[model samples]
Target: MDGDDRAGGLTRRRRWPWVVLVLAVVVAVVVAVLFLANDREPEAAPQPADPEVVTLPVPTPTIDPIDVEPGTRFFESLPRTVLEYALTESTADQAAVASGAVEAYRLVLGDGGTTEVVVLASQWRDADAAGAAFDELLAAEAAAAGIPVDQVGTPTGSADDAAAGEQTQDPAAPTEEPTEPAAPTEPTLEQGPVEVDGTQVGRYLLVTRPDGSGTVHWTNGTALLRLDGPATAVRDVYAAFPL
Candidate 1:
């Protein structure tokens, strides 16, 4: 089922900022923005890339027990940066994205004792759909947090993740500090933890109207995930999910 069509009762198409392919330039832009945001200090070179691939199942999105961890039942823990970078690396191959179908995961992690993380891992129906949604999600997130964002032309192809590389980490990777985005803008932001159903969410963002809820939400094939929490816990959430 399409992620947008899952809501049976009241479903309506909401116009979101059009997302182009997740290309090299786009990734660079995102990286530049993160740097400008002072999200991190000059750190030692990125751990020697242990280019590896970790595949997860494609499942529908839904709330699970709070005690139980989020994401698919397959992989135990995957980090945000690794997944993001892998997706970036996979796009370098044009022929790959053109005639390829990968079973991957879409994850949204943040720091928090009770924040909700949405890990939408699945096989995308096509490259176009994957790239479009991936870019759109990035734009929406930037706008919500008032992070300056500009759309760029799609170069070659831009879809994240692939079966190309094995997912492995340099055991020497830094685990001490969590790289945090600059304080996000809050047209509607709440502090402290809140309860949803029977679970307590540390924090969450209600982006400008038409901006609905959920910290991060996207779909690939039959899989969808919406992980959200407070702004304060964003860093923690990202750190919690180590690929």
Candidate 2:
């Protein structure tokens, strides 16, 4: 009986070591799986892409004001700055009296005196005198250009006449319904009857000189004006001029 008991004890002890080894292997597998799961980073939540950026444009200012004291009423009424040009000088010229003008004024305007514009304004006794003077000036300019006076510009109806429409009907004819007047066409550079704000103000003449500079002449009421500057700059100044 003793020998049988000793053999059973040895078998039970060997079975215990096998069971312990199996438990150890199971624990090692569980720890390895836990470590691997902790090491793996979670997928970053899908980030929304940055919104696209857009840009817009800026507008330019038309008028630029400056500080200056205009000596005469005519000069005082004039704008200090016409677009980019500034009025830099104003003077009453007695020499202009020789030309039959009651009052003659000269204005010097420029972009820092780099691009210059010289304005000569003269007031006359009456509309007839002004008209005659304008004709003489036109003739002089035409002769300087070596062209006929008519070629300079053909006289067109005033802005008032144009806006009202010309009406001519025979006295014997029956009256009909009046129709809407057609829109007045805008005049271009070197064109007759210069207009401002859709109204014919005066006749325009551009005279190119031997040099790059040029002269622009126009009449307003009892006053005649002449502007001299670089050809391109003079055009801009004339367009920007209020009177």
Best candidate, TM-score? 2
Give the per-residue lDDT digits (tens) of candidate 2, residues 1-243: 899999999999889989999999999999999999999999999999999887643222243445665455756666666667776777786766688888888878767636778888887777567778877877877776666676555444577786565355456788788999755332222536766678765676776654567788877776778899888878778877777
lDDT comparing candidate 2 with the true structure: 0.72
lDDT of every model, 2 decimals? 0.40, 0.72
TM-scores for candidates 1 onward, in order: 0.25, 0.54
Q: Which residue pairs overlap in candidate 2's backbone?
A: none
lDDT, candidate 1, 60-149, per-residue tens: 223322233444443334333322221111112233234332445444432222334444443446545555555555566656555544
Query: How accurate locally is residue 159 in candidate 1, as Cα lDDT from 0 to 100?
Result: 39
User: Ten residues in a row with the worst lDDT in model 2?
Assistant: 56-65
